[model samples]
Target: MTADRSVLPRQCRGQAGMPHEAPHTAPPCCAGPDRENHSGKDSTGSDAGSDAEGQRNQAVFTPDGLTARAMGISCAAACNPACSDPELRRLLTASGISAWQTDRLREVLALAAEASPYYRQALQGVDPASISARGGLHRLPLLHADVLRRAPLSLLCTSQDDVARVVTLDTSGTSGRPKRLFFSEEDLNATVEFFSWGMLSVGHPGDTVLAVLPGERPASVGRLLGTALENAGMRSVAGNMGQGAPALARLAHTEKAAVIVGSASHVRHLALAWQQAGYDPGSIHTVLLCWDSVPPAVAGLIRRIFGCRVLVHWGMTETGLGGALGCGHQGLHLREADLLAEVIDPVTGTPLPDGQEGELVITTLRRRTMPLIRYRTGDLARLLAGACPCGSPLRRISPGRGRTGEGITLPDGGSLYPADLDNILLPLAGLHDFEACWQPWAGTPLQITLYPAPAAGTDRTLRQQAEKALADSPLPAALTRHGGTMFHVARTAPQAGFGKRRIRVIPQGTPPLNSGESYHEQLP
Candidate 1:
C-alpha cells in the first residue's frame, strides 16, 4: 500500500531562518543526447550560482533531467526545512528515466570495462546492455574492500597522467597491505559540487564557515570543503582539530563563523571547551558531525551546549566524501543521481526490504577514474520504511548506523558495541574522552580510563559520575552487579584525534596488571 506522506509526522522540523532558495547546480556531467547542457559556469568558474546570483545563471530545473548536483531541490516551508520541492517528487518517482536508459550508468560501465584491468576481468561475459533487462545493479557481484587492497592500480579506468591525487589508508591488521584510491580532476570537481549543494542546508552566501578537519594536504577533506563553500559564495576557513578545542573556539569567535563542521568526537570536545570558556553560542548557527557513527548522547550535548542545529553526515573516502547528507529531519537523503545505494542481508548477501537492517552497498554512476560497483560499506543500517515527512522523493537512510564487525561478546552471552558506552558516557559533564578494556577472566571485567577536559582537570568526582552513569545503563549495570568494574581518571590531556572509539578485549589467560600501569591499547 502507498503510504500518505503529506500526513506523516514532522519529526525534527521547526528550525527557523533556513533559506528556501535552490542551491547552485553544476553543469551536466552526464548529459546525453536527450538531455542538453545549457548552463554555463558562473564567474567563479564552478557551478551556476543560485537564482539570485543574476541573469548569467542559466541552470533550469527540468523534472526529467539530472545533473551533477543531483538537481538541487528547495523544500519551501518555514517549519520543515528538510523537505525537497514538490517538483522533485516527479523527478525521483514516476517521471524519472529507467536504469536501462540512463546514459551515466552506461558510460561508467563502458569506461570501466574498456580501460580498467580489474573491471575488464571481473565483468567478463556480463553485458552492460543486458543489465536493465536482467535486473539492475543488484545483479552485479559485490565488490569487497579486499579487492582495493589487493589491486588498486588495476581499478583505475583513466590514464595515469590524469590522476590528480591518491589517498592511501592502512588496513586493520598489521600484515595487511594498505588500500589506495585514485581521483582525477573531474572526479574531484564532482565532489566539490556535491559539497556546495549539501552546505546550503546550513549556510548562506557571505556566511563564514569554520571547518575543523585536516587541511594540511592539498587533497584533504578540509581543502575540498573550503573550495566548495567558496564556490557557493561563502567564506570558509579550514582548520585542523590538532590545534585543540580551545584554539578552535577562539578562531570561531574571531571569524564569527555561522557553521562548524567536524567529526562527532572533535566537535563534542570543542563544544565542551566552548561552553567552559563561556563563549556565546549565538555566533554559530549549525554544527555538522561526520566521519563516524554519531552517538545520541554526544549529539544531545552538542545541541545543548551550542544552542544550534546539529546535523549528521554519513560518508567515507570510498564514497568520494559525499554519499548521504542529513536532511535536518530524521534521516539522510541519498545522492540519487551520482550513486546507486542498496541495503542487503549481511549474512546471505540477499537484498533486504526497506526498514530491514542490512549492509549498505554503493555503485558509482558518474565516477570515471575509479568506479566502484556494488561496493560493500560494512555498515549496518536500513532504508527508512516510508516517504519522509518533508515529501522528498529521494530515498532516506535511517540514523541508526554502526560498523558490522564491531560487536564484542560478553560473559552473559550478550554483546557490547562502542556505541553502547558512547551513549552512556560521552554526555557526562567534565568528561572529555575515554577508553574501555574488557578482561573477562579478571575480577574487574570492564576497565575504563577517563580523560577530563582541560578546564575541568582530573577530579575524583568525575570518576564517581562516570561510574554512576554506567551503573544506570542496563548492560553495564548488570555486568557491574555480577563481575565488577574499574574506573581510572588519567591526568594526561585527552587525545585530540577524532578516530572512532572501541573497547579493548583482553585475552582470558593474560595475567592481570596493576591499574597504575598504562593500559592504552592501539585502536585500529
Candidate 2:
C-alpha cells in the first residue's frame, strides 16, 4: 500500500535523505545565502530557473527572512537532543544562541509574572535569580485549570498583533470544560518541524494520507499537520469523521488513500462500516490512532480489515500535534527533547521512580507564547527507563488507566476510573456503543446504556454478559435491568456539578432519579 510514483517524476522520490533525489522546490518567502546551491533545472519546460533563483536569493537574504530562519533553526535544535545535548548547548552558547534564548526565557517569565494576575499571585515574592540558578520547577506553584479559565490572554508576554494563531482545544473527555490555547508564529513552525520528523519515521515522501479527524475547524493540530505533510512532499485529504461512518467509508474509497489517521472511536466506526460494505481495508498501509486509548477489540478489527500496520500516538492540544509516537518496533516513545516529563504522586506532588504509577508533569522547552513550566497533566501513567527496541533514546510511557472522580462509593471507599470499565467492556463481543451514568437514589445502582449489534439483540443474553463483566467487581446489591438495549444501574452521587463520575463506588447519601434527566446529561 505504499505510494505509486507513476504519476510523479521518476526522480521525485518520497521524503528527503532517501537513496534517490527529487527536484527541490524553494519554499516561499525564504532563501539562504547559498541560493545557488538550491538552484536547479526547473521541472516546468521553460528558462525560468534563472529568474526564480535570482528572486529566491533576494528574498532569503532579507533581514526579516534571515531572522525567521534563524529562529526556526534554533527552535528545531532546542527540541532535538542530538543537537541540544550539554556539549551542543555549550557550542550553541559559544555561538551566541544560548545566551539569547536564556535572556528571552528570563524576559518572558518576568513579564508573565508581572502582568499575569494568576502568576503574580502564585509567584508572589519569588526571586527571578533563584529560578534561573536552581532550575527548581517543583518549587514554583502549579498553574491549574481554574487559573487558566479566569485569566485573560494579555497574561502572556506576546500581544495579539504578534500572535500568529489561536488554537482551541477541548479538554480530554475527562473534563467537560474546553480551553483556548495561543501560539506565536515561531511556536507554530516548531510544531510543524516536530510533526514532519515523527511522520518521516513511518511514512515515505509523497504518501497519500487521509486525515479522518474533525475537519474544516480552526484546530491548530490539524492545520500544523497539513502544513507538515506538504513540507514532507506528501499529499493529504481531510475527512470529517464526526459526520458518521457512512460518510467516512465513502471518502476512504473515493480518495484511494494509503494512510488513515483519526480518533480510535472514529476509526473503529469506519472499520465497521467498511466491513458492512464488503470492502477490504487492506489497501491502507498505515493507520494512526490519536486522542483515546486503542481498545484491543478495535485494534483486532482494524488489523483484520486493513491487513496493515496500525500505530497509536498520544498528546494533548496544549502539547501540539504529538508528544509520543509508536515506533515500527516499539510501543510508544516519548519525545524527551521537546518536553521534560516526570511522573509524581497525584496526592502528594512528589516525584516517583520509574514504573510507579502517578500523575504526569511536563516542562516544555519548545513552547513560547505561554510556556508551560512543570504543568500538571491529569493523565495517570508510569515512565519506564532504558532504550527502546526501536533504538530511540527517548523514554516510554506505559499504557495507563483514566482518572478517578465522583460516582458511586465502594464498600472500601475507593473511587473507580473510567478505564476500569473500558478494560472490561471493550473486549466483549456484540457490544457496539455504551454510556455509563450515576443516579442518586436510596441505594445507588450502576446504569450502563448499551447499543448492541442486531445479531446479538436478545435482552436476556446482553444482561447475562453485563452481569458476567461486573461479576467480581464490588457493584451495589441491586442490579436493575431496563427492557431496551440499554441497561440502567442506580447509584448515589454528590450531583451533576460535583466533578467527574466514578462508577465503582457510591456516596453514602442517595437521591431520587428524575425521569426527564437522560444519562448523557449526567456525564462530565
Candidate 3:
C-alpha cells in the first residue's frame, strides 16, 4: 500500500517538488538496482536464489553446468537483434545507439504487451510490434516507479514458478509499504555477465577483491558481488561495513585485498579507518563505488589514501546490478547490450536531448521474467552523445544525482539534492571526513551542521584539517540563499541512523513532510 498522505507527520509535508523533512525518510525511494535488497532471500514462498535441492536439479548456477544452462537461458530470451555481439560492442563503445535504442524499444513493448496485465490494458488497441522505436514510443504510457512499487504483480509477464527472486524494497514515507520486484534466473545471469564485462575495466582474474557491503546472508548483495567477481576470474570476500572504518582497514590489510567494492560512505569510512590506524591504504589497487553517489570528496579521499583509481558502477536493484561502469574517461560507459537508458524531463515525462540533465528511465533488453519498460528511475543523469576519450563507442552518461524525492527543499521553492550539497563539500581537500545533518530549528533559519571527522591521539591534525575544509567551502552562501538558513561547521558524524551509504542526515524525531510521498503514486 502507498503511504497515507493525510497522516504524514507535519515535518514530512512539503510543496510542489520537495518533500519536507521526513524523519527516516526512505532512501529517496530511488534505490540502485537491487542495491538494498541484494542481501537475504526474497520472501517468495520457495527459495528466491539458489536452492541446494534445486541446485542439484539445475546445472545453470554450477561451474561445469553453465554451458547448457547458458545456452538454454540465451535461447529463452528472444534474441535482441540490435544488441547482439559485434553490433552491441559498437553501440557501447562507438555510435548507433539511437538506432539500437529504437529496436530495443520495439522489443520491450512486445514483451510487455504480451505478458503484463497493466500494459495489456494500457495498450489494448495498439500493436506493440508496430510501434515505432524512434518517434512512436512516447505514444505508449510511461511506467512510474511507484506503480511498480504498488501493483508490481500486475506488471509480471511470467508465471510465478519462473520468478527466481522477489526483491522487497522499503522506502522512506508515512506508509510502510515496500516495493516488491521480481526477477528470473536469466535476469540474474544477465547481471553477472555484465559484471564480468565491467570488471575488465580495472580488474584482473586473479585479483582478491574485498566487498564491504552490508548483509551476511549467503544470498546477500555482498555474496552476489563476490560471485560476480569470481565470474570475472577474481576472488571476493564480504566483511563488516557497520563496524566502522578501523576494522575494515585491518581486514583489507590483513587479507591483502587488491580491490575493494563498496558504497561511497563505506569506502570513505574505510579511508578514515585506515588513517586512524596508520594503516597505509595505498596497498589496495582499486576502489569500486556502487549504489550511492561518490562526491569529489570521496573520490579524492580514496585516491589519496589508496593510491588507486576510483571507478563508479551505476545500477539499481530494479535493473539487477552493475548496469554501467566508469572508464578512465570523463563519464560512465553503459552496458548497452543489456539495459537501455533514456533521459527525460521528470515532470513532463518527455524525453530529453543528449547532454541535458533529466530523470533516467530504463528498459531491459535482455530480461524475460519481469521486463521494465520505460521505468522512471527517479535518479537524475544525462546522456552524452559525444565520444568518450577512452575510445569506447558505447554511449555514456553523467554519474546520476541523488533521487529527486531526496532533495533538500529550499524555502523559496528552490531545492538542493544531497548530491548538489555534497558537490560543494566533496572538493574540500584537507578534511579527513564530513557528515551533513539537518537539525531542529524553531526560527526561520535552517540549521545545518558539518561535523568534522577528527582523528585519534593527542597530536592529531583534525582542527587544522577542519579549518582548511571550511576555507574550501562557502558555508553560508553555499547552503543558504536569501538568508533563510544558517550553517555551522561542527566536528562529528551524526551518531544515529546515518545508515551505510547516507551522506545527508535528518535529525531523529523530526516530524515528516505534510504532503508526504503521494506525488508519484500514479504508477498504475
Candidate 4:
C-alpha cells in the first residue's frame, strides 16, 4: 500500500519558528501547481514561493516529501548566514539560478590569486579574467598528493584568523602521510547546510541519527552532519565502531536512532555482532553508507537485518560533504551548485563524452579555502547526460570501477585493482575478512589473506570456498592453506603503498617506494 502523505505525528513538528522543525500541517498560503506557491521559478523551471506556511505543511503532511522539505529549510537557514543571503532561496526559485555560485566563485578566485603562492606560480601567464571562461579541467595541472602534503597549509587561501576549524584527512593510510585541510566559518556553515538538505531527501526531520565513522574527535563530515541534524530538530549520537560492534549496538538501542551512517564495512561488522546477540535493528528507518562501495549482496543483507532503506553517497575530503547521492530512483544526483564534475581519458587527459568511462575529475565552484580546479580523483567512472527524474538539475556519475592511482599491471596488459578484488571476495558467503597483497617478480603476484567465517566451523570448508573464488582468475596454482585462512598468489600485484595492506608490487631487486616520490617516478 502507498503510504499516506498528509498525516504527521506531533513530535515530528518540533518547536515553532525553528527552521529545522517540521513545517506546520496548516494549509499553504499560496495555491499553485502541486499545492505549492508560485513566488518564482527554479533553475529547472520549478516554481518557488513565499509560502513558509506551505513549505511547513508539506514537510509534515507528505511522508515521502516531508523529509526533503525539512532538509531544504534547515540547509537554507544554516548556509544563508555565510554562503547565501536570506533572499537567496527566493531568488534561486524565482530566477532559476543560485546566486551563491556566482558570488563564491568570485570570492575564491580573488582569495587564491592574492594568498596562494602555489596558485600564483601555477597560474603564471594565465589571465585571471579568462580563467572562468576556459572549459575542461585538463587545461589546469593536476594537484598530486605529495604537492598538497609539502605545500604550506596556508596556501589554501583562507586567512588563519578567519579559520574556525581544521581537519586532517588520511587517504586509506596507503599514502603514509595525511593532508590537513582548513575550514572557514563560512565553509563550515555551508557544509552543514548542504548536508542538512541532502539528508532530507531520504529521512524526516527529528529522526535520530547514529554515526560510526573513524576518530574520537568528530571528522569534518561528522561534525557538519551532526549540526545539520540538530538544526533540523533531530538528535544524533556519534558511536565509535572501532570499539567493536557490541558497543555500537548498545548505543543504537539506547538512542533509538532512526538512521545509521558509516562505512559499509563498519556497518556490516555491527550487523553481524547484533545478529550474534539475537538483536535485530528493525527500528532503524534508513542507513546512509559512505566511504566504500556497497556490494549488492551486502546491501540485501543489511536491509534484511535492519529493515531500513540503504542509501550510498560519493565525495572527497577537499569537497566538504558536497557530493553525489542516490535518490529513490537509484540514480546519483550531483550537487551542481557546489561542484562541476567531469570524466576524461586516463592516458590522454581528454574529456570524454557522456556515458563513456574514464577517470573522474572535479572542480570546486563553492569552495573558498581550497578551490580545487580540475583535481584528478583517479576514480574510474562515466558522466550521465540528461536530467534526473527526481527534478534536480545536478550532474550524475556512474558507479566507479577501480582505484584511480593504484592498480596491478598484468603481463597481458590488463589491470587489477584492490576495489576489484574487494568486489570479487566480499560477496562470498564463507568469507569473513580478507586482505590482498601484491608481490612483484618478473610481473606482479597477488597474495590474498583470507579470514573464514567462524560459523563454517572447519578450516577445510573455508579453504574450498577460497580456492573456488580464485580458480577462474589468472592466479598461480600453488594456493597455500594456513590455519583457517588461505593465500592465493597471482602474476600481477598492486604497487607499493597502493593496497590498504602492505602489498608491494616493486620488483624483488628494486628499492622500496617512498611517499616523497611523485606519480611520474612510480609509473616510469
Among these predictions, the greatest TM-score belongs to 1
- Of 1 and 3, which scores higher on TM-score? 1
Q: Candidates' TM-scores? A: 0.80, 0.69, 0.72, 0.72
Cα lDDT, all candidates:
0.66, 0.53, 0.56, 0.55
Query: Which window of ten consecutive residues has the lowest lDDT sum in model 3?
Result: 58-67
Where's the lowest-lDDT run of ten residues in candidate 1? 30-39
Candidate 3 total steric clashes: 30
Model 4 residue 420 distance off true place after TM-score fit, in angstroms = 2.0
Global CA lDDT computed for model 4: 0.55
lDDT preference between candidates 1 and 4, better one: 1
Instruction: For residues 1-524, write the lDDT of model 2, one tens digit per residue.
Output: 11112211222223132224445543332122221222322111112124433433232111111122334533322332111122222223212433334444455457667765556676777765555311455666665554455553634655677666666545434354456666676666666665655565445455777776544554345656776666556677887755566677877877877778876666766777777777765667777877666554566566567666666677876666567776533346665445556777888888788888888776555565676655677777777766443333446676566542322344355444555565566445555555565444423345565555434556566657876776644432323331112354322212212022235322445343453233554334
lDDT of each residue in 157-245, candidate 1, tens digit only: 87888788899876443267888899887778777766755675556555889998877778678888877776545689866777878
Which residue runs of candidate 2 sit more than 4 Å off their true CA positions?
1-135, 152-154, 168-178, 328-331, 404-409, 440-444, 453-518, 521-524
Model 3, 204-257: lDDT tens digits are 445778887754553446656666665445677777755656777888888888
**Positional deviation of 182 in candidate 4, in angstroms?**
1.9
TM-score of 1: 0.80
Per-prediction tally of clashes:
0, 20, 30, 11
Q: By descending lDDT, how would the candidates be arranged?
A: 1, 3, 4, 2
Clash pairs (backbone) in predicted model 1: none
Residue lDDT tens for model 4, 1-524: 11121122233323211244445442232111122121222211222334434433322211112222322434322221112223323422312323334344455656676778787777565544444412423455665556656764745776577666676656663555677767676666666655655665445555788877543444356666776666555677887755656678877877888788887666776666566667656677677777666555565566668766666777766677657776533346666666667788888888888889898887677666767766677778787777544443345677565556677665556666665565556555555556654554523245455565445445556556666766654443322211111253222222212113223354466543332221223432
